[model samples]
Target chain A: MKSLIIGIVAGILCTFSFIPQVAKIIRTKHTKDLSLITFSALSLGVFLWLIYGLMIKEFPVIAANAVTLILSLTIVMMKIKHG
Target chain B: MKSLIIGIVAGILCTFSFIPQVAKIIRTKHTKDLSLITFSALSLGVFLWLIYGLMIKEFPVIAANAVTLILSLTIVMMKIKHG
Candidate 1:
């Protein structure tokens, strides 16, 4: 039970981490130091994770990765736009 | 098997996604546009993920989150240093 709670907290943190990054990008309109490759790879990876979660029918995994995928894609787009 | 492969690939990509970001930070020495909150949250998040993986005795989760924790910490440090 403790571990499950820890995992959920961790998943929430990781999934929402990009929210500030998106805000920063929008506020500063700069991505010179941000890596396009990183966001791109993240988007792809999280997308796959989402798919895997669906295949396994895991609700937590699917929910977390779905949010993460959207966040990562947002960063990717911002990186490209600001670069 | 297919889902496992996809999961593995996703894990690998997400684990190594920070390599390019680290390289970019090192080369550019700029993180003004990068969000410290993002990296800090990511580091903490991945650390908890690692702990949860350990508790669950899952090798793949442990390995992936371990690497991700390290990478996210690196970014956090770089962001602080460069900012």
Candidate 2:
């Protein structure tokens, strides 16, 4: 139970960590300092994580990576648009 | 196994994703556009993941998050120093 809760919180933190970056970019339209390669790599990585989760049949990993992928992609798009 | 390989690749991608960002910041030293909150929260998240990995006795998880934590913290520090 403790492990599950901790893991869930950890997943949530890592997944939503991209949210603020997205909001900042949208609000300021300033992405000059954000690295396109970083976000692109992250998105690909998260996508693989989602695949791994699916293979392992773990809902938390799948769900977390799904949300993370979207946010990371959004950042990538914003970086491209604003770069 | 295929699963292990995929997971390892995913972990590598995610873990090293921050490298380019760090390199960019060091080169440019411009973080006005970077989101401090994003990196800070990400560092926290990665730290928790390390703890979770330790608790669960998962070497891959622990190792990945350990490196990620350092990289993410470096980012947070750069954000603070530059911003």
Best by lDDT: 1
Top DockQ hit = 1
Q: What lDDT score belongs to each candidate, Candidate 1 first?
A: 0.91, 0.90
Model 1 chain A weakest 10-residue run by lDDT:
A74-83
Worst 10 residues of 2 chain B by lDDT: B1-10
Q: Write the per-residue lDDT of candidate 2 for residues A1-83, one digit (tens) a residue.
A: 78878878888888888888899989999999888999999999999999999999988888999999999999999889988
True contacts kept of each: 0.95, 0.83
Q: Specify the poorest-scoring 10-residue window by lDDT in model 1 chain B.
A: B74-83
Evaluated with TM-score, which candidate comes out highest? 1
Q: Candidate 1, chain A: TM-score?
A: 0.96
What RMSD value applies to candidate 2? Answer: 1.0
Runs off by more than 4 Å, candidate 1 = none
Give all candidate RMSDs, comma-separated: 0.8, 1.0
